[model samples]
Target: MAVAPQVLPHTAISTWSGFVYQGKLALYHCLKLMSSDYAANRDLKLQLESQDDFAIFRRQQCLSMHQVKAYKDPRFSAYSDGISTQRDNARQRGVALAYFHVAREVTNVPATFVADYGPVRFYTYPIPPDAAGNVIQSFCPLNQVDMFIRDELSSLLVNAAMQPAWKNYIVANIQNTLEAIVNLKVIMTHSKIHESTRHQTVIAASEFIEFSELYDVIEANDYAPFENEAFFLSRLQIDIGTYYQEFCERQDSLSQAACQKLDDYLAAITSLNVEGMKAFLRATMPHKKGRFKTLSEFKDQSLDRDAMRLGMFTIFWKLVQTARNDGSDVAFSWLNDGLFYYPTGIHHAAEHQESICHDIMQQAISEDVECLFECGALITSAIDRPSISDVIIGIDATEGVDTAEHELLRENRIGNYKKVAMISLNNVPESLKDAEPD
Candidate 1:
């Protein structure tokens, strides 16, 4: 865990920076173990040095720290797309030896220690071994590794920054380490979820947390995270899906509606062409073609947008049908992602929002539909009452029009009234409000 400032010179720093930023040097390079004596100090040292034996893989322009002339590979690099581990090389033993505790804890991490690395706060919890195996011979690799990583990060902080906070102790580069651990996870989880899935780290979640925390710290002054909803939403949705899946699995029946949907979905799975089936599916669920802003539009311009949503929904519904027809598993997979699933990725669930929309519309009807209707009638009444329809006559000014920017009110030149307000076309039948006269 001993880490001292490597004393990277200014020129070396600039060169390394350019190499990393330009994608020359990947975050990690695989190293091999030296001799059979994994415990021997000299063996471990030689193994770590062996990492330099292989020419680093990259395009020719990427070579900056090269000590030798460019040499072509006798046999191409073993890994193509990022491989977790290269054939155990002697050169990597130094890292292994230095990070041996990291290796130990990988096998012996404790449950409480893992929880301490709260996914929410993302502050890593490290557990280092003070004394070796107890007299009882009980060992927790997870605890050992966490402690090692935590301690190592603490030491690195002394050199990395002038004043490193507790936050810096949780390293972001641990994804590679984690991925390797998950793949090499001989360690088991009691949770019903697949060990692979339960532990699989999404890089984006880290980015989101880092960006969010960065925003919180620096937001008061000048720092603004350029990343938008898309960056956050994709990862958030994955988390949501994972959580929902867990909830569903934990309970015998997660939701009656979900169960019914699955049942209907299953029943319809066989008879793909039935309109009765499709109709039932349409009634019970949301589809891609039905994407919408809101069911209750208070503006005229919203109709086109809603129409576009409806069109997307139609495409989504059929797309869902097609995916279902092709394979239910595929349909579920796509639904989980909110994508069209096969090709289009048109966000089809928006199309069938009515399933949720029905609840909203019903609440409006049940609460105060009559009072709403009556109040609206008074303002639009052609006969009795103080109707503001003809009150504001001969008005030519557009001063107050800015408030109606969304087309909640339509401009109508009715005879003497140059521009009179009328309820927008897409709004409910409830906008006939009494207004001031000109």
Candidate 2:
């Protein structure tokens, strides 16, 4: 839903893919208010300090300055990985406060503001995965009081660039702030997504929005697991599974065929004999027995299910395209499913796809039938309107043949093709000129 910077038809679903960084900042603000410490305040009033992106406060007293920096580039240190430099910056801010004597002037400020000192923390979204493939939150506590002045101070001197005295003065001011900067912390914002806390957030958010469309809205807004922390965290006491079931029941446009396939797929996955499947897969993938074994251990991982659904959808889409081309008159069985749920437009669904190959691969590994997979895929890829297939391919041939990369490239490619297809459809000739017609 948050595939690009556009709005979905007949729905409030709109997205700004470029504003990912800004959205994270907003998420951070909501997270701060969700904190137990802030919420427990008898008079929990706060204001936004635009000095940094946002500074958290309560009762006119500032607590922390949240500087959100999204680092997707491999060269930069991700917040999940915890870097020494980020910690050092936090330490430097603390040192600067001491050196500038700004903390001492706290009481001299106006009554509208509290001169309280707080940590300058950097928050990064999409916390990187650890060796175990789990999202990890990294927090570095840099103490200004504990840092060795001689070593820390000397490290700042670049003899070729500046004199030691000047560097010392600069580093001192930067490290110690008149704000009495506290320790720096680098947090992985989405670290708890797979945990119970995330379930709680999801359940709570459903209270304000339809549970069926809650994730869709959050995902479309910024791809953050939870867009508004305050609303999502409000009803944390609800039963997540129960609410989710209720949400699913209310989804109006889903095709019965799609639902049936989903049920069968889930049943097949649940009924798998992990040990038997591992042994069976090991005969051909002798060296990768461990991979199958590990996969078997996690019976229905949401991510794996999503991927499976995508595969199913892609295959079904190809069938639909073939059927449409052949001019089959059997009205589509899952038209509603295809229209409301899928991620891509009808014309662009399965563009650049090798659906037959996927069908074979899926049949080999899954107990579920290929038709079931196709139905699932069709439902997932559904768009708002049904149109003739666009001629544009989802990705350039030069982009390489990786499936994941193709899916990524398709996000950008599919939108353009849909626009072209719509224009073509709208610009039909005034009347069909037959051989007999002038």
Candidate 3:
């Protein structure tokens, strides 16, 4: 019996993430080509233009460049258009044209060279004709030594699929890019205070979150529900009311300052004032840095903040379920006072609380659980600067809290924690540790 040809999995290039992955894959291929070229002749210094996804280099004092594209289909018109555009771009960049595409197509119009790289076929354009007006044969390199290097690099790209380490590197990069985009969108949409500052903060937070594991947990847990803005606000309003009523019932057991803080939170939630809510949380939360603070003090405060945020997320998730479950229109407060008691037992208290406030605040705020969760996570990750493992551990430890609320929080926390933990460098596939990209 004849063996069947193996079919490689088709990756969609339509979605934003897919498009980015395709670009990165193309870059990876180009990088391999550059490395191979360097190995052949160290004098040939090749540089890749990341912005345009093209390789440009000075060969024998003449500029030569290759633009790369990955296409799923062999549409002649699309291919022709891409070639023309890339040629134009190369001309503008002052370089010779050698366009590369991942797709394989047998067309009569252009001088093309085809080479197979594992399961994928790469087509290079503008292969010069011979003196007799005959085109160079496909897969036939003008130079045998250059072809050998090309084959080697191509094999490496193909082998990347077979190697766990290379696979992890590719997957991690794609995931990190997608996460950064998600984080930026979340921060941009929800942040209403201090436009310039917020923009800068969002950029910084996004850069940090792109590589960090915190946003993964926030994203996975649906803590930033940008899509369900109205529903989330309504549910949050209801949960806040419920929390306020509960607080009143237990006012006798709580301290005067704690009760006052709850009253402030109640007022903020009732009015749908995000700044006020932020203030309430900031004042109550114990994650601020203080003068003359010890290393132990910082770590303890960070752990406490992480736990409280995790617990808060747990409460938020419960409220979301409640909203989904009978379409509960009843108003109840959602913020858990159990997570943080104000003015007492709070470490690293804000020294200049009034100075910390931003003058430019959102007049009207629309927020979901995700936005709330993202804000806290960003603040902790960017400002607190806790170790990734410490943050994960702190949040994960919420699983052990004895209270019913903490139990509810713990169940969801475990899953989110696991999801984020898997992406961490220490927890990623062992092969990833050894993988070095071309």
Candidate 4:
């Protein structure tokens, strides 16, 4: 159902936090922040799910709001003590509603209840649930969530962007979150596919609506939240092509809607200028001085080996500066697409005809994507599968540029260096460079 105008409505808000949220929303007029700093503590989440911890969660939320209201108790309303007293009713109620994440988990708060009037108005109500199959714990208000997390997550991400000492921990958490969100989408897709196939086999047509209302508040972020790496999509995999041809017809019909959505999205993305669009084209690409001097210069370029290393830090900083000042988290999902679409982006020794992996590795290391270290006794490691990548980038070679790799190369590393992956060794040939150990 379309959300009523009251819950996160479109009017200009008046509360301080609401104003801040508005300010951030204005800043990122069209951006989404997929944080490199998002860390879902499963242990903590599970602990929050426990019946014992419900009170703590509620208390934290309620007290936090109470304190906030008191501090910013500007002359907004007359309800001196209640949540309605705030300048922005939706903003205050939002925080209060989230406390229901606790109430629904621990107490007898039903997920949805009928608020009956003479008209029997049925608003989407918050119901309580136990730790088992709990949805409330996972319910993050698309608008309210990062308002609390921005500062903490930004500090963490900026630090990690610099390749912090605890970068391994951060990378592991990020990967784990990615896996969880991806798996969640997969699970949702499978369930939808099963339901869809069954419905098609039995009935003529059926539609499955979802709690995608969350996708509504994510508008300021340009619905980019829906395109998130972890977005929940219901993929219907009917036997599209079959001897009976019934499934084929069904797929053909559905493809119309799907293709239209895809076209709209693609068109929106294409509106970016040449340089902005090229970042997504490849990871790293070299440019000649005068070839299409401005970003308007375009050429039909195929996939290249060093594509991942092609972009600069300033590009991401531009996006970040736009996002942070406006008010959105950096969407790190772009990294996933980069990895999948440009698998061979990492610099390879054979491709470039030189032992550049040492330089890349040095860069990844100083920036905190350090794969391994030959410590006193134990083999110290930072990231997962860098050992595998060491082989791909040819960084494991005992000979070739071992002792003299430039440390300056390390400082040049940019953006989530820990997640840096390697692809093919289609680089320079054997006579590319002397295997100098200087």
| Candidate closest to the true structure, highest TM-score | 3
Global fold similarity of model 3 (TM-score): 0.27
Candidate rank order under TM-score: 3, 1, 2, 4
1-438: candidate 2 lDDT, tens digit per residue: 455452111111011111122222333333323333322532432222122223343443334433333222323223222323323333543322111111011122223221222232223222358788866333211111113232322342333223335445444333222111110010111111212332533321221111123112212323233322222211110111122223333444445454443333222222223333332222211111122224323222212222323333332322222111123221122233242112211222334234422322332233221122222222223222232123233324224448877766555434422331111112222221111211
Instruction: Kindly list the per-residue Cα lDDT of model 1 for residues 1-438, writing each as its tens digit.
Output: 897553211111111101111111111111111111212312111111012211221222111111111111211131111111221221222222111101111222335532432211111222334487333222222213334333443443344322336445334323223222221111111111112232222211111111122212311222123222222222222222223223333344223434333323322222222223232222222212332222211111112233222322222222222233242322221222222222111122433333323332232222221111212211110112222234333332233467655243334212212211212112213211112111
Candidate 3: Cα lDDT at 14:
17
- Which of 3 and 4 is the better model by TM-score? 3
- Cα miss at 33, model 2 (Å)? 5.6
Model 3 CA lDDT for position 29: 37
Best candidate, lDDT-wise? Answer: 3
Compose the digit string of candidate 3's lDDT tens values, residues 1-438.
Answer: 996573221111111112222233333333354344433433433332321333334342324444344333445555565455555544544444454444245354433422211112234423359788755432322123233333433444345323334433344333333333433322222222112332432332222111123223222423333323333233333333333433343323443444334433333234434333333333333234332123222223322432333333222221211111123211222222222111211222234222221110110011111212211111211122211122333123353356867766655544432221101112222322223211
lDDT, candidate 4, at 293? 27
Q: Report the lDDT of model 4 for residue 386.
A: 34
Tell me the whole-model lDDT of each prediction, alpha carbons only. 0.23, 0.27, 0.31, 0.25
lDDT of 4 by residue, 1-438 (tens): 986673211211111112122222211211112222223211111111111111112211321111111122223232223322222332533433212111011222234422211111111212257668543342223234334334333344445334334434343333223323323332232233333423421221111111122112221223334333222111000000011112112232323333333222222222233333333222233111122222323232323212322222112211111111112111111222223111122332334422343454443332222122211010011111232223234343322334455443332332233344433322212222123211
CA lDDT for candidate 2 = 0.27
The alpha-carbon deviation from the true structure for residue 397 of candidate 2, after best TM-score superposition, in angstroms, is: 40
Between the candidate structures 1 and 4, which one is better when assessed by lDDT? 4
Query: What's model 4's TM-score?
Result: 0.20
RMSD of 2: 22.4
RMSD of 1: 22.0
Give candidate 2 misplaced runs (Cα > 4 Å).
Answer: 1-35, 38-42, 45-49, 59-61, 74-136, 139-438
